[model samples]
Target: MVEVKLHDIGEGMTEADINCYLVKPGDFVKADDPLVEVQTDKMTAEIPAPRSGVIKELLLTPGQTVKVGTTLLIMEDSSGGSKTVELQKVAEAVNSEAPQADAAVVVLDRPAEVKVPVGVSARLGRILASPYTRKVARENAVNIMEVKGTGPAGRITEEDILAFVKLRDHGGASTSEAGSEQQVPNISKYASEQEVPNVSQRASESKAPNVSEVGSEVKTAAGHETVGKSQDILPFRGRRKQIAKKMVQSIYTIPHCTHFEEIDVSELIALREEIKASGNSISATAFFIKALSIGLKEFPVFNAKLDEENESIQLLREHHIGIAVDTPEGLIVPVIRNVEQKNLKQIHDEMKRLTKLALDDKLTVQDISGGTFTISNVGPLGGSIGATPIIQHPQTALVSFHKTKKRPVATDQDEIVIRSIMNLSMAFDHRVADGATAVAFTNRFAQLIENPKLMLLELM
Candidate 1:
């Protein structure tokens, strides 16, 4: 028997998420066969077999993140006469009918089941982190090479990525010898270039202070202030980490200002009910998409991104509107492409299709990409009447639609009656366009929602 360890995926990769196993135990695979697809934050790569042999055992399961150089499997040597070991379902938990260790498994396709321990490997790959960790490091513009590993066998963990970032962000006193280090120029002294991302890496490597003599907030001589309670440290993980990164980017980069308008959609509600009665369950969101499409056509700035580097506003030709779907995994905005070209029925069907895919975690990268503008509905969540939603960074603007409620309204004849009203909250990048532009966009959309027929009048 020979041990098959995970080889280095890339120069910076320390680990990767086991996306799926192409070949299982009892299967004879040849050299260069794609054994597993592994994912890091930035890319997914395939790990191929080093030599031809029968797969004796699999050490990792799908979605199980493991470090590089870990024992991937035990394989029968090509020159040996051992029979191929039968395999068990990787997803199925090994029964404890026979007393054994935690990671022990029974080998099959033999005369008797042989119990073996598939322990974590101590072999270190060139890098020691999973691809996801490396990806986070790259997205934050932190170099993986600079991070110190703390996982088993001195492997890099997610916390290591965050630590490096924190150290760079909160530049405390340099622990290194000040005399030995080369002095770097202060960033504030120099004008920012078009490539802002490079500035950080330069600062990190140059031993230069970011601003005001390396951030007074980080005083190495004085330790951190004590908190009131004893705290438990938790990693920034999964959906929470993703949300934090986006929120931070949006808040820091976008000059956001919000505007709200109460739209009376009584007629729109009636139309929705009539559509439902006709055996078509279409949502008000579909109506809003069609309505917003008209507004976008008239005022293209709402469908534009402010290209600061070029000092210009990029008006997107396609009206791909993103519908924010709250999935169990996280909040994902699956875009409905070319909404302006599609009618209400088509939009509804696409919405249903994408929503199902999003919930099932089956959405491809294409399904969620290329959103010109975003619409986040608070109606389905059912708690808030209205909220100020943040823009989906670089998109320039987003519309927040609240739940519809019956409210008393005064008619043109001065007669009071109850009507279904919903709030349309618009948030836009103030740097790209002024308040007038955002307001005009919001008002036009509100008009269409109030009278759904107006959306069909100017089709496509």
Candidate 2:
């Protein structure tokens, strides 16, 4: 029997939620056949089978969080005839009794059924903490069984252990003995009861010495002191944690440099308004994506991602743009495939569908994969001017668009007039491109936006 353990899903992913299982027990699978889909904070990845075999068991369930190195599924080698048949029998037995079993079963090679150990309550003389809590206790050299539990199901929580440490330092007296439970005792009572020296009074009572005596006084070497400032301890647990880690890694690994340009998109804005005025439904993001697709043909380098494992750069001929959507949980980028071949109307329809799916959390693994570039817009929130955006890893660049506002700009003839101006900032990896190359690319992008006709042209 071979166990398929959870492998690293890139970007330092240590854990993920099991999204779904593609195959069930007793199903035959070939090498590289997708077995399950797992969702990390960053992306949804489909894990494929390592070898051809019959699935013996699925160790994890959907919606369960699994760490790296945890056994996800077990498969029996088909080479051994009787052994494979025996494995199938074991699998059938486990599946048939799994839902009805009162005790959790830990399946081993042996035929005899062995029950996994149940957790004992700390007050009952054994640690009643979870594996995670036990890890934390071991790191701090605290005995898990000695700590009192304040968690559901009598589990020992981190807060409970910290409170115990405070009690130990304060002479082992319960807070109730200090009068008001919420308040500490007076210095006199505290010092007398705890037998701790009162440094403030002792310093005040010291005799006044001569200047030489004071100068000759010895002092202990200073050790590092912690800055006693409160920090927002956001748990690095779900989607948000994944986004944060990926963004930080991308920023550090890729030498990102942003170049910003203001475009007089008054014509595009007028066109959109006319379309809307005629009772037509369209999104500004779709228009932006169409313009970017045209720009990418002229600047193919921007339509590429770094192939780090091969130590080479991969420039994709096909344009697959990822639209960044802000969901309640976190940011999710769903890709719109084959943008270069799609017309403006098709792009708009796909954008609408993808956005709805993203908001509803109904996006599939295929919808989130194969993005060559990304587009993030803050225009809906009414923020003018764009800022640098981090490149989604492997992708070389990301374009950030700001809200268009009426601003004065000098025309070619040097006459200033009010026009709809929008900020466009393209952040690219400097390691893959230089300033002149980025500037030339942005200039072409600016020209395409300035003249909608240029964007409509099929330039191969």
Candidate 3:
């Protein structure tokens, strides 16, 4: 038997929730087979098996959070070895605290299960809740099990608590003891209330929502009313949860300020057409990427990050720009590395490759790693004219490029003329640069878009 520990899967992600278990005890598996799906802070990934084996036991449940390096399960390898011999080897390996540990894996014999106290599980129905949800429930003094959980397997979630609070208070109607009357279930005296000692501290941060909840009925200030439609409760796991985690961290840590401007892209459009006419496949995003790389060189702060501990700035020399791609799975930002080294065609081809891999769910951590900056083209998706985008964390800046259209603009001679104009919505970490610096970077970027010759010159 080998111990299956939760591996450190992503870029510095220390903990994750077991989103789902693909196998159960007694199931046979092959090496590289997906044993479970895990949702980390950065992404949703499948943890594959290291060796073929029959599952011995599952130590966790869905929505149960665990830290990296925690032993999640014990699986017996199907190598036709004697059970007693394998167990002996495992015991030896565990007892061996040698200076140089062997490559062979050791699995602990399953500990004897302590019978759950009588009447506890029967009363509370196990009260399974994510750490974040449990934290919220404790803060609000709500017994999580009393609340009818709308989550998978009747699991209580953070949103359930939020909705419960809202329905009880009726939009802050009264903060008296009266508000507590119409509340959820209470914990029985027998409920365990034992905390999982090994849970990650980040789980109690209250930054990310555990699930999306909507109350079926809410009391309006005038009176009570039905919500009219059945509400859908979505599990805040997988990619959505990852996005929420990063966005929350970004908003709380970075003092972000956006600089908005417009640029005429008629010349850039004409250049794209000319290239396409020559049987090339360069994209509009490639143009923006090249322009942004040149702009970053001109204004280094836009490509830099603020190191608060060291009280200094770290300016990155390479131009690895992340393109925010909205895939069916979720919003994934795949990085285009060393944009300054690649020509327009190269950028286009790489973007297509990365986007395809992302959509196909074949993108490895390396494919999406190492972004010095980000650009999100939210315009083509067709929602609003512009956007005040949130900065991707650890990176200092992100620019939201909106749709281009034939809009009337005043020429140098003050005559109104139609031009293909687009909006550039950019946000920068204030600690890294001031508004003037951000504007300077955007201005240089805009100039390159207006005149392709300058961008081509940068390439030379």
Top-lDDT structure, candidate number? 3
- Model 1, 1-460: lDDT tens digits are 7777776654334565665555445455556755666654323456777886666678887656677789878877655663322222210133233222112222232323321211111110023345445456656776554455556533456777677677777774132311012111111111111111221232122111112232324423377744443443443333444456677889899988998889998998898888889888777888888888889989998899888888899998799999998864467888899998898889999999998877655566577778899999887677677677888887989998887788899999999999988877888898888998877888888788887877767753
Candidate 3 C-alpha lDDT tens digits along 1-460: 7888899876777678786555555444557756666766545676777886666778997777788898888888868466534543543453242212111122333332332211112111233355346557656756443454556534556677777677666654232321221212222221123222212232232323444547778656698586853445666665676678889999999998988999899998898898889998688988888889888888888888788899999999999999888865478888899997888888889998998876645677887888999999877876557777899889999999998889898989999998998888999998878998888788888888999878767655
Candidate 1 global TM-score: 0.57
**Candidate 1 Cα lDDT to native:** 0.63
Clashing pairs in 1: 14-127, 14-128, 14-129, 15-129, 15-130, 15-131, 16-130, 40-131, 41-131
State TM-scores per candidate. Answer: 0.57, 0.57, 0.68
RMSD of each: 18.4, 17.3, 15.6
Tens-place lDDT per residue, model 2, 393-435, is 8789999888888888888999999998888898998877787
Candidates 1 and 2, the one with greater lDDT: 2
Cα deviation in Å at residue 169, candidate 1? 52
Error of 1 at 375 (Å): 1.1
Best by TM-score: 3
Off by over 4 Å in 1: 1-235
